[model samples]
Target chain A: GAGVSQSPSNKVTEKGKDVELRCDPISGHTALYWYRQRLGQGLEFLIYFQGNSAPDKSGLPSDRFSAERTGESVSTLTIQRTQQEDSAVYLCASSLGQGLSYEQYFGPGTRLTVT
Target chain B: AQSVTQLDSQVPVFEEAPVELRCNYSSSVSVYLFWYVQYPNQGLQLLLKYLSGSTLVKGINGFEAEFNKSQTSFHLRKPSVHISDTAEYFCAVISVSGGYQKVTFGIGTKLQVIP
Candidate 1:
């Protein structure tokens, strides 16, 4: 019954610091995804996890971005040495499966600001 | 690869007036189309999706979209809009022909419903 949820509704950090955004997907969901939304821009795919398979990291802009999901439950997105360009809203979504037909339910997102 | 294009960045329409949000996509293979709405300070919500079968798909809040394979388009429309309908609408596509189904989202359209 619960929807996706994310922690730290807002985060402010230094340019060289690292930040971790957490996401709690809906119960029984087997698919989870992370995206970045910059101001005045669209959602950019970051990574995704489906069950026990290897996560898709193709959309990661750099090596600093990494994510991990523990057995189809909670997921965490970590950004190392954050930059001003990485300042944006980090959103998480989950679905029943990896099927193209399944709909994704999104979380409120964590707004990260680098100063 | 798949990509989505939202022609208009913003659309201002009076309440109870018909409105359309244009969306076009390009993909090397067959794809699934979707529309998502985002309210202020909130995450995206699925408005509708076109997986297969009928070309005309209906969604929540009296919204609908027609999938045109020939023109590579999936435009969202509503007979009448409410002031509460003011939000950002996003068009997305996912290719079904391949290994990993990555969703590509458009820049989005900001719909400002004037009362």
Candidate 2:
């Protein structure tokens, strides 16, 4: 079976521009998550989506960061007015359901460089 | 709220030698612990997890972790390591309180297996 996958493995954009990163979770996964990983740092939780429930946006660092998921499939993370600090690896993960017990499958990640 | 701490930033061990990576977490409520490994240029993968029963959890690639509730720790260990074991390891925890499940990750520990 195909594992979770992210598109545009590498993206370079202007600091003021907006960028959208896409993720395709494994088949039948009902929960998805987004995270940011800066060089030499840990994974920073960004947002989570479970089935049709309202997405968990509490981890969003700022109003400029937002994510959307349709049903239980694809998810897109959009960053508005990106800053140099936004440069990092954007990782996407998914699991069988919405709980801590389920194992998360991660995507290769999209490296965004805000120039 | 939950937080994870990885005591060592790096662990260097000779091939075929034992290795240990310490991790500690704090949370007001019950939690689930997990260990993830990330090889260079690849996505993160689950190494092991401790959700319920069985304090000693085994994972892929001859990896294992022991969950110590009293010490609030879940340290990863391997009896012997191979050069291919060189990678970054991250410890994570999710608080299972209220309706939301928020996961926190520790700053990864880089494992350098010297041959």
Candidate 2 local distance difference test against the native: 0.92
DockQ for each of the predicted structures, in order? 0.79, 0.79
The residue pairs found clashing in candidate 1 are none
Off by over 4 Å in 2: A99-101
lDDT of the structure predicted as candidate 1: 0.92
What is the per-residue lDDT of model 1 for residues B20-71, given as tens digits with 9 covering 90 to 100?
A: 9999999988888999999887789999999989999999999999999999
Measured against the true structure, the TM-scores of the candidates, in listed sequence, are 0.96, 0.97
Q: Which pairs of residues clash in candidate 2, taking residues 3 or more apart in a chain or in different chains? A: none
Q: What are the lDDT figures for the candidates, one per model?
A: 0.92, 0.92
A1-115, model 2: which lDDT tens digit per residue? 9999999999999999999999999989998999999999999999988788788898899999999998989999999999999999999999887453468899999999999
- Model 1: what is its DockQ? 0.79
